[model samples]
Target: MRIEKEYRIFEDIEEVRIFNATKKDFYKPTPKEFDVEDMPFQELLNNVSTEIHSFIPYENGKDFIIQRLGTFTLNKYNSKPKDAMGRRLSKISPLFFDILHEYFLEVYESHTPKKIRFVYYNGKKLTKLSTAKIVFDMDRIFVVTNNVDTATNRRVDADYRTFDEDKTNMMENFSQTGSYYKVHGKYVWSQGVYNIINRAKEDSDDFYNIVFDLVIPEDQHIVDKIFYLTNNETSQCGEVIRIRTANGVMKVIEVNIYSYFDDSGIIIRQGLINDITQRSDYGLSKPVDFLMDGFKNSKKLALLIEPLSKKQYEFSKGFYYMIEKDYGDYNHSRKIMKNIVEKDVVKNLNKLINGELDKIDEVLTFKVDGNSNNKKIVELYIERFNYNNEVHSLGFLTDVTEDIEKQDKLVASNEQKVVLIKEIHHRVKNNLQVLNSFLNLEKRAYKNDPDLIIEHMQTRLTSLALLHEKTYGTKDFVNINLKDYLVDHDMKTEGFMELPSQVEFETIVDEDLNLSIEVITPLLLIIDELTMNAIKHAFPDNTATDNKITKQITKLNEGDARLIIKDNGVGIPDSKSISKNLGCEIIKSLTSQLGGKISLIECEKGTAYELIFPIRMDHTIN
Candidate 1:
């Protein structure tokens, strides 16, 4: 069995009438006068049978047409709107035309025909409003005023119909600000809006001859979709979009729209488009991007640097303008750092980038060409980011004049304190030498004593004084190099032997080793006692031609130190009895002071002594 369908939608004095000829379905003979004002468009479209096509809202003064209503019409005939009518058989209504207007205009707001999901109920359970759907013609929704003549770059006028004043004044104004629809996405009635847009486009003839053509090709569908959103009844705000200018230049702008629907079903739209190219969040007013024009007024010069490239980068004249005084990578280093203070800052900066320094809050102050009054102090802050496989640093330079003045004053005070400290060290070293001289004078009185105790006392005082002599030789008064001390002490003690020219001395020190004066002093005195003992007993047969002394100091991988001394000499006749000697007791005390052990072993050709101790690195600051 085949089916035929037809619909009649007519309006009378009191209510609208809708009838389906095929099924003989009617919503009402007199759709009982319900106030259209109270009727939400959804409920009214719901009340009518889904077979009414061509919703013609006819009034005495105005003509309105609603097409593409197949879901409501249940029409089997799906054809295009008639190009030239042959005759009126329920007036040439088709599925596409009737349902397009039904779902988009009547069922919802003025939008391009799209498949919208709507819940409905004939009598019992809720279901989709229409199984039939209409494809969206996103192109046709925007007509006439949107037309752009490729040659002239001009907008064509959209035809309009005039109505009564007081009631339609808002509609007339809306038509001027925003192009609007009259017959729900079918026709536009914009007079003022098209005129203003055309005029604005004409005024900026050089760059954008067609201002009304500012609508971006891709954005047309979005604009249509936005106006049709369910709850967006009254207003829509701040829809930013990209638009083409007269010369096809892209610009960013913000648009706002307001919807006005009168009781007579007259729809109006009002909108505002503002160019935000120079907004703070955009290019012109930004910290980096604003440098084109804004930096000419700024007292400081901000640089855009690429450390990896280390070269000049051209600025876009229209977008970015480099200040003539600003330094690029090629010249910035030499230009910024002329004085010692600033040069030191550059050195430290390299250290920071090389991972040698960890401090970030660096400040440097310098005077330009000896002008003390023109001192400028800058507190630098840096941030790092990775770009193009290279780590880059962005730095902000801010003047800190007041803070630097305070720092300079404090630095001068610190310099005075440093001078005072250095003088004290000088005095301490000199006082120690003077005390050694006083002891030498006192030892003169005990010269006649047996075993020459006064002689040993004099040698010990001389060794202690040598420590101060070494301290005064270096800039750092606290820490001393063990290797340098060993070399110097060996040279000084060579002349103590009766035949010093015949004896050969050799010293071997580890690659990197340093010790404090406190540790070296006890060891120096121990070496002195051993050297004196070697001179008295080592070559007892008066054989200086075969005499040789060797000293070795090494730092082990396990953080311990070893000292070895060997001399070609007659071994101790009574090594046990030597423990009773005052010199032996002193050596043991000195070894204990260093927290080490001393061993005496007679080798094949000489006597050998080995000292082992922990290499404590706790003492750093003087």
Candidate 2:
């Protein structure tokens, strides 16, 4: 007969494809070759001993076996010999038989699949199988993966996290520094002493300066003596020493060591060191008044770099507060450097740690999430210091978003105030100069006539005061509103100024036009002098027989504005006389100050005075 085998896998267990594959030579091919029901119980027991796996057996079930293949057998590899009680040895033990019986019962009762390497057929050979081996029609079962922290090494408890913020981390970071020699320590053959000590030195040799003022004795003999005394009980097992961090804070450490012969037959010592700086027995916990002295009140997260490991940093709580994060070390490293964006910053940070840079006090602006375009500025401050003999960089990062914004606003406000103050000063100076000129003119020409002098001074003072008012009254002091100023006052000079109501005064102002106080103040005063000159001298006798008079006003060009005051009474004298008059001299001086030019034109009606000046169109009114 041909043989075929298959493993049909399933949940819980696998199935055997062949229910009863027989190697027996039966009396009839389709009839029972083994007559279990017909055979006597004793004969079945005898058959079990003869061919152990020919019949199915169960625990405490010798009565229920196929009658002819009665007695139970055991798996030879796991079977135990009978003891001194005179019991005989069996191929299968009672306990395993019980297990087998229960397993078979479960299969028979529930039709569940079970993989069993049972002796197959009368040939009594074991065959591999799975729960799915049987050709049974059943619905497919769904399988799901379970997520949990599982350790394949069941008895091992170590997954060292050097940043657990507890004693476990402290122990791992400052673990015993040397290994037990296999021959000397009996069972500790895991790590060699030399390898352990060398790695310890590589990790910490640079940090051992003066070490708490209890420096390790340099003399070889003294060190040996101390070790021997410690082992012999003449000295304590540990020596207390201080170790300073690069940040300059000193911490206490306890060192213990044992000497032994290694596999190389060389004498070696293994050491265990403990940092006891914060322990209560060390008295560093502090008095009541100092208990909470240096604790931070700010919400910023703090992390310490000393005695930290890459794995610990990957799982750090401080990193959790950042907007971006990944679950592994490679991702952490990629983004930590990648997010910086500025290559120079990374270069300088390396230099800072290497003691090549003076300091790292800079604002690092980057996206909150590594890949985002939104940026934030953080003040990264790092300082280098030496502890023991090792160099370390201590860094502090602070978000300066609010602070920078407030600083910018304050600077803008102060700048505006300064401009306002300067404008006020300019206005004061202009009015004072106008007052000086008015007083000079009155004292020189109208001194003999008190009434005339007072009258002229009052009118001049009013104009000067009105100009000051216009400059101060509006919030914008840099530029004077020309349109408003034109109509602001009535030009009310009581004795010296009177124009016919029929003599219409008209003005044109560009919507976008204004003049700086520096230019406008002098120009306005000059306009006052010229207007009085035209009214007083140009129309001397009101002699025009016509019923109406008119004055022409105009603008000269795009940047230049013109003021023309013309009348119909009379014409001006010769240029020589006008230039020689004190009023003309004042007008000329004021024009010069205003960066303007004044012209007197002879017209058919009378005289026309023209004042042309530059105007600042930037500061405009609608």
By lDDT, who's the top model here? 1
**Residue-level lDDT tens digits of model 1 in 1-622:** 1212222111100111122222222111111121212112544553554432333332420222333232323222332223211222123333223323333343234433333222222222221222223232421221111111123433222322332323232222322223333222222323433333333333223212133346688776655455444124333434766566444445555566545554664443434444554452546321122333443444444333332124422222211122223333234344434543666777876775665664456777756544666666666655444421235454445556666678898997688568646755765675467446534544564456634554555566666667667775554445678888778777766644344436777889886877765567667777877777776677766535868778898987556788888888777778789887656776887789777889987688777898887666344333
* Runs off by more than 4 Å, candidate 2: 1-348, 351-377, 381-406, 415-423, 472-478, 491-505, 538-559, 568-576, 616-622
lDDT, candidate 2, 520-620, per-residue tens: 66776776666666655654445444422333334566678876766665566577787887788888888887777788776776666777877642332
**Candidate number achieving the greatest TM-score relative to the actual structure:** 2
- lDDT at 188, model 2: 25
lDDT of the candidates, in the order given: 0.48, 0.45
Q: Which portions of model 1 miss their true places by more than 4 Å?
A: 1-466, 469-473, 477-479, 495-501, 617-622
What is candidate 2's CA lDDT for residue 472? Answer: 63
